[model samples]
Target: MFLIVEESGPWKVDAVKAGLTHSLADFRIVESRVSSVETEERIRLLVLGLLTKMSRVRPNNSASDGSSVDCEGHVGYEGEGEDVGRVGERRVNMGNKLSSKQKKKRKEKVASSLQIRNDFLTGRSLTTEREKCYDPRDRTLTFVNGDDDLDFLCEDFKSLRAKMSCGHAVTPMSLTNWCRRLLDQGECRFVCGQTDCHVEWPFEEVCKMALLTKEEMEYFEKTLFRNVAQDYLDVKVCPGCKSRVVRADLSELSVECTTCTAAKKRPYMFCWQCLREWRGPAPRSDRCENYGCINQPLETLRNCLHITFNDVRGVTGCPCIRACPTCGLLVEHNKTQCKNIICLRCKVEFCFVCLKLTEECLKSSTHFQACSTGVAPRQTSIPVWQRK
Candidate 1:
């Protein structure tokens, strides 16, 4: 049994000298004064004072060996013996264990304090103080009623003036209505409402500027992802389950729907070109087995009449309607702007004459001049569902 005293008081000079000269396990008090009687008397007085204090705080129980134990498990004996030194060693070990636990707790607290959370859109770590200061709504513009320089024509343009990343200003209500219209019209990208600006907004920034609710944001993300997937991949909705499925082999028109097959316990296949039940053979590319199964967009691209550019000379015999090289959406030239036209669905700009990307066409020819390769031949090799 050991008596454990928490070290709280200042150490005396004699106690310090004794600690330096003796082993930590030794509990014997050294005699510093030449008079032995005075030293013994002082030791007796110190022991009596400690015992009195301990008796006031704890109930004493005697051990079988005549040592007194307290409720806290501290043991005190009335004699100086070898057992006392062993008790001191045990106290030191207990103190070391307590200090180690305290150090571990402190380290854990520091690690937790330094931890940071990442922003979903920017992929940047944000500290608690910096996160509190972040607000997307702070990006706004004030519009005066009589300001003639303003070009916005919407009714809520004055009430809701939110500035976009492109430095163009738009109203919240107008932005939401425009974006909703785009989604409803099968378009995925959100562009500025300003005429000729056509700057596309990032999805995350659009959500912030529109102040969309949770449900609206979820719907927008889902629809936008589906529309973009269709533009880039050979995807079609299953007729049975209505689940979107991608065609692995673009050469074949038949696409298998795994979800429907699992539910019905039979292999289910559908026509990628028509979105109807597969009635034809395994690998037909021209048309599915179903009667009158044809790619309408491709037919429109192939048989559309040719139109002459009224404003630009030497750019005649171009197709009146052309499929966007990126998304395959049919777009008719307005005949008023340069031969370059922007697709409404995918928001891609391409040359109406050459049916190629506007950037590539402009490398060799001017905006209104004839394409370097002349009008591109009808694109018959690539399927309507596949992008360039």
Candidate 2:
């Protein structure tokens, strides 16, 4: 006789026992009571039935923590934990493997912002490779039609064609000369010289378009820094080392040259007004001990030549060079443009004829017409010394 036992959740044990029986083969007969062939076949059939029922049972879907219950009422978790760990590892690896282009792009973004101190002291390049949208070396000029106008401010615009950001075609030589002219004229903003198209080109963009060399770029930056510094601060060139120095105390004319003092191993100072070695008292706003130590800038303001406007009439006794009312920086008029000129230093627009704010001047008369009050008397903040 054979005894067949059935249980509610004994499928796991039964499956393991069935596996052992198959592996042990004839040894299973010696380990237990010998049974008939029919009894052994019945046991095999019963184990198979239990395994089929367990395989068909579905895992519980109501578990909230990604855990499921099997037919044996035990908890088993999903593979999401392993997947999340793998994703975190991938993110960490990606952070350390940034490409060179990505790093360069990040650097360029920071360089684009204006830093006045950095620009004035160490200087900033107006031209960088990232700003070079149009390179003549790798690019050829494209003409829309045979009727393209090549009339730019530069005479050499016709030869060695290269298009600027403003859509005007210019040669490298011509672009260089034009930009240099603007800088020499104390123009901080580089505007397109093409007539009727006064699009302002960024400094970096201009550097690339002009194909400036290292020496040319340095010169441009230096000139730009000098122009900007002269507008806002009382800057003077050190007589000892010829390095540009800023006056810390505007009330005192004497300025110490740190560069020269460090080089000479002693204190070195210069007269701000005279641009010579400081010979007078420690801190005197007026003239130094040296004879004829007058303010040259003030003298220029008092004795500058009178200007005559080309288009506007009835303008007389207006100085060709006028001091900016705001910053007192000397600005020269081209005499070919309108009566009103913008001060490059202070960026204040005033009448070159009436010497009043553009808004106040325009209220009384048109740009081409004479000012309501003829030429205004020159206003100088510094008292001009009469020549003895």
Candidate 3:
């Protein structure tokens, strides 16, 4: 009988090989070289089980000599072997969503259950043919469950990710915008849909998801240093120095600076993910002290302190949008780019409230009545009705 390893547990190749020594004797032990995806998966599971069992059998934290024990593919406190468990076991992170097992069970339940389609809901199924869900406009899943089964679909199917830093709802269509705007928007809050545990997630977790989902990430995962005893999945952003010379490989430096080629180099170091220097003017806002900040370009002070989720946990209040101190106008507390906000009245560059240049005020056809004039503008000029 073919052996099947459980989710977290790996299989022992030696055991399997030994078991089949006489009986089909030629059975191949699973390895990384397995050509098929299915075969590779099976092999990984067996190895996981094998590695886990091996670690349990020998609880010693190190090789006998203990000159700083460096077990070939192991990590953790050398003296503390109990902490080490399965090899390369990916802990199910229930960040704003249920665990992977739970999600799989839910999907299985949906597949096995008798679903009554809700025709009016308007969408195709993700499991169905691609042409069905191909709606050019919204570019979303629309409806994964059959329209008739829409009502029957579990409410937990909503693993919808939101835009980074803005906290705006997102879909596959908005994925592009999410990556683009992440830097513009500082740490965002992603609220879970479970309703009961409507917890909010931090930006780091969001980036974690992004890096995990990255197309090139799989190739990178293969490059990671694996530990056969303790299981962990830590993804480091690809090393790219956004400065006078950007290095593509991340192995060059653990810390990097986020700066451009032209702008004045600011002292702010790059964040582990975004690679942007943390020079935001918002108070209590610190820096990402990664390496390579010396090459970055910033307009203001370079913040070099790192902030944890707990650091910003109780912190409430939107970041202060400051104005130029001299003009008594609204200023950007931390933004480095000079906007085109022009003060039509002051004739300098500023919107009445903030003495800052609007990056492009004239090109903006939107309404901006001077808040001071008390003249509400429908489009641009003060509204005739509100003027009185």
Candidate 4:
């Protein structure tokens, strides 16, 4: 028998040779030494017993201390135990906890995705794509029906205005301008544009449809009834302020304007028939007893004497071509030196640049000295026939 021992750091290896004892060269290696094998088996048994005791004791200790013990491969209160069993148990528990957290996160992600889908399908989402239907810059309302959508650029303004009078749809400012043009063209009556609809609208109703302001409506009425109608215009020009006035029915021939009365601070009445100052009740006569006055009808005087709507050159066809600043006679600037015009009726010199008396012009002949004529005039879009 022979024994061999090998040492590698902390580990020991023991071998024994045993044979039939015939010759020394005929021995064969059999097994480890009995003492070494018995020591290794005792050590394994001790380790297993310590692991079992630790597993059974750890729970009791944790319960008493009210805290969990992490004993994966770590020595505890008893100093040493089996590391493999503790490590295996820790790995299993850790995997279960991680899987539970991962499942919860996945469920939350799915729920958020479903909420977004529902908002989009139900048309509750606020998105940029939906804002293109209307422009915020225009500040105009859109007309939307189940199938119809009308933006700012719809049908023509005159056509829309005809429809708007019957409350079909709202008309924009451009449509209002068309309505005004039609009124200016002597079309006082309006009818609904819808098919088979015969709703006649008055001039005041057209003004309402156009959404004119109080001042604008008054101006329009004055222009339509007082200025445009030649034979029917019953208004007289106030000598005090040049404001127009219409006589009340069945009233006396005396006329007084609010503007004249307010400015003069005393009672001021004029003869309605002759436009002369009414100092006292006068016996009815063919004309007012003003000096050098011939009896002429006030309506004839107010009427435009020679209204030529058309001309050879469209540029010179404006009915209000020019009026004499001195005597209010309508005159056209046809000759040279027209800026320094001399009114034949009044025999007064007037400056065309400032439309003031040319006597105020200095002796140096600077007729337009104080005039701010720097900005060129803008061309009119209306044709010659429609200028009136």
Clashes per candidate (backbone, < 3 Å): 0, 1, 38, 0
Candidate ranking (lDDT, best to worst): 2, 1, 4, 3
Writing each residue's lDDT as its tens digit, candidate 1 over 1-388 gives 1111112221111222222232222322221111111124323433433212211111112333444443233455445332321232222334434577788996886554333111211212232211011122232334223321223453423333445677766544456667877887777678776667878786666665554543455566555555555455445667887765656676778777877788999988888788898995787877887888987877887898888776766877787987778766777887875899998756779898898898999999998788889998776644244333
What TM-score does candidate 2 reach? 0.47
lDDT of 2 by residue, 1-388 (tens): 1111112211122222222221111111111111111123323433433112211111212144445432223444554222221232221344756799988986775564324223312323323311111222233344222222333442423333556677876655567778898889886567887679988877666665565654567567656554545444455667787766656566788788877788999988788888889996787887788788987777788788888788887777888887766556678988786788886656779887777889999999988888988887765555221211
Worst 10 residues of 2 by lDDT: 28-37
Winner by TM-score between candidate 4 and candidate 3: 4
lDDT of 3 by residue, 245-296 (tens): 2223322322333332224464433343344544333222123343444422
Model 4: how far is 299 from its true place, Å? 11
Candidate 2's C-alpha runs over 4 A off are 1-163, 169-174, 213-233, 249-251, 263-266, 300-322, 331-348, 352-354, 365-388
Better of 1 and 2 by TM-score: 1
lDDT of each structure?
0.55, 0.56, 0.29, 0.39
Question: Clashing residue pairs in candidate 1, if any?
Answer: none
User: Global CA lDDT of candidate 2, please?
Assistant: 0.56
Best-performing candidate as measured by lDDT? 2
